[model samples]
Target: MALPTLHYLSHFEPSGYGLSAIAMVRALRNAGYPVRWTPLKRVGYDQVAVMSWPQALTEASHWLRDDESLSDLPALAVVAAVVPLAGAAGFTIAHVAPELLAAVFATAAAESAHFERVAYTTWESDALPVHWLRCFDLCHRLVVPSRFNQAVFAGDLRRPVQVVPHVRRHRTNEFSAPDLVELRSTLDIAPDEFIFYSINQFEPRKNYRALIAAFVQAFSSADKVVLVIKTGSIGWADGPFFEPVQVRQHLQQMLLRMRREIKSDLPKICLIDAANLGGRRMDALHAMGDCYVSLTHGEGFGMGACEAACAGNPVLMTGWGGQLDFLGGDYPGNLPYTLEAAPVWPPERPSFWPSQRWAACSIDGAVQAMQGVVASPDEFRRLALERAESIHMQLSEPSVAAAWATVFAAS
Candidate 1:
């Protein structure tokens, strides 16, 4: 029998979801499945041109034109789209937010033939919102990225949920020595300074407020330690506050407030505001960090921390969520936290379900985690290096290919 053409649909932009879609396409092709790639055009978000995409994704870009008609999809093809479906028929995998499932169903309903729908979704809380159950009934199958997410959805949905981990594209091994030196020079990072790097949007669940407070409380200017933060706004989802300048202003006001309360010299912070530094440049950025830190309240999959760990940086993360499936239980760099109700920030627009519980990372624990890294940098780096190999192997091309193969086979 001939291999089926995978009709993969996703946004081809700079955000996490966009990159993961590109990774999935690369993996599917490597698994010997012919693919018909389609880009999901969004209102405000701009898709990256095919020529500018990472080298691996460039090969798959030729599979189909961006404006190609999906109405004429091949008979032997299976459709998989992220979030809002593009009105394609047949086996449809909708990678969407739980709240948006109703919209996904509505979009698919426009099609005449019944498409076997699969919801590829995830929730960060121990239990998903009670309201989502009705939406869950619309899908024929459900797929999630982690066991934690699967458990959250399975019992309530009363269905077998498949766990396929996110495909991370890292160029750690490919980064040259000169690339590292140039990146360091570009950032003005000194040789003696120990760097604590973090990459995330200025979102409520990310808990940047806690991370910033802990960093200042943990180290002073005399320690020669700097916190480098890389953040930018997402056009599709992010509000005005997440824009680089606004984020910088928020950080500035925060530090100013901390200075008044603490009355002590504070360490410097370097903020890089860009949509995303993709491919080998991302590797070079990760290579420059002495340690990676995130005090996030919750995560469907902690991509930044995972990428940093894979690149051999000691990760200081709150010990909870989907990340635990990959980061493991006994990882030395795990930080301490208390499980509590998720907070309602920016009261007008809540990022989380306040009734549902998520990790509230201890400020003291974050401080201690940073201090421990400062105390014995070598040991942390050594542990991270040891885990990096296993992470690479676990998420390698063949492993991801096999996982996707299973998903398609069962479909």
Candidate 2:
């Protein structure tokens, strides 16, 4: 029984979509599927943002560059394009916002003939826009990350909507003694100070403003605590890549404003906005954290939080959205939130519309969650360790591969 070669099309950049595509391809290969990858040109960028793939994946298949033709592809090869679809004719998974689906369908349709399209997408809201009903008609099947997303999409489309979560790539290593010392020195922190780390784009829906405010309120300058935010910016022209200097400047201004509002000395905040951070460095960053925090309004699939959990950090997240799929109801770190109208930022091209509702975290709840972690770090770490193994097994490469195989089989 020969496995069909997967003619996968996706971005190779460091953005969420790019990372998810890379993980999906690796999972498929790990499950013994043959793959012939096509690296898609990132929207609004001239050259491919990240030229390198994981070395193990490079060994798995010779990835197709933009100039390279896949005319030689085997007849039986299945196509799975990460969305925007690039006019690919088979399964299309999306990392783009659901609001952009109409445009994606329009562009893809204009470029190529209609082909069997199994579209994988996710949404953060409870309801979709009325116009999306028609756009979804173009896709053969819809796959989402959680039951939350499933219900949202299923309500609008009269098609099968399946839940296939984003894969959780395990963090590479545990903390070595040298690693700990170096991490402390690099960040200029004390050995015993607790670190609450979060990785997210500096976007409105991410709710960074609230998180920063909560952190300041939760712990004072004298507390042995630090908040490390690894962030980037998503530009209209350049897609989801980061500009470290620009992001740093923006964050610094934000911090200054926040400091003035508080009218008090603030706890140390370490901001990391690097785009070229390597895997080992990322693993170290994850390891440095005593707890992973996400005060996000919502997520289609909370990749950063999941990655942090995999790194054995006790996660303190807004108790809503796709993250609940893996974190579960019993997870101790879930922060309470209110169902508020989802915000529409930038106004011109909003990712979410006014009618939709998403979770809004209570600042009090966030502060309390942080306080709990600070009061009993070891206890939380124990719970996190217990949770980590199950999470690692549950969303590992093999697990996600199996899920993908089921979706492909049905399609």
CA shift of 226, model 1, Å = 0.7
Writing each residue's lDDT as its tens digit, candidate 2 over 1-411 gives 555444454555556775677677767766887554555444441222222234323432333221112222222123322223243344444334444444444444443434344566677778876655776666666778787788778777766788888888633545688977897888898998889999887766788878998999998899999998887643211113322336666667777987898888899999875453445566678877899998998987788888888777899999888888888878999999999886554455455666788888999999998999999888999998888888888888888877777777783
**Candidate 2, poorest ten consecutive residues by summed lDDT:** 66-75
How well does candidate 1 score on lDDT at residue 269? 86
Q: Please identify model 1 stretches exceeding 4 Å from their true place.
A: 1-5, 44-90, 99-115, 170-174, 233-245, 276-280, 345-351
Model 2, which residues run further than 4 Å from truth? 1-5, 44-115, 129-131, 170-175, 233-246
List clashing residue pairs in candidate 2. none
Error of 2 at 103 (Å): 8.9
| Alpha-carbon lDDT, every model | 0.69, 0.69
User: Total clashes, candidate 2?
Assistant: 0
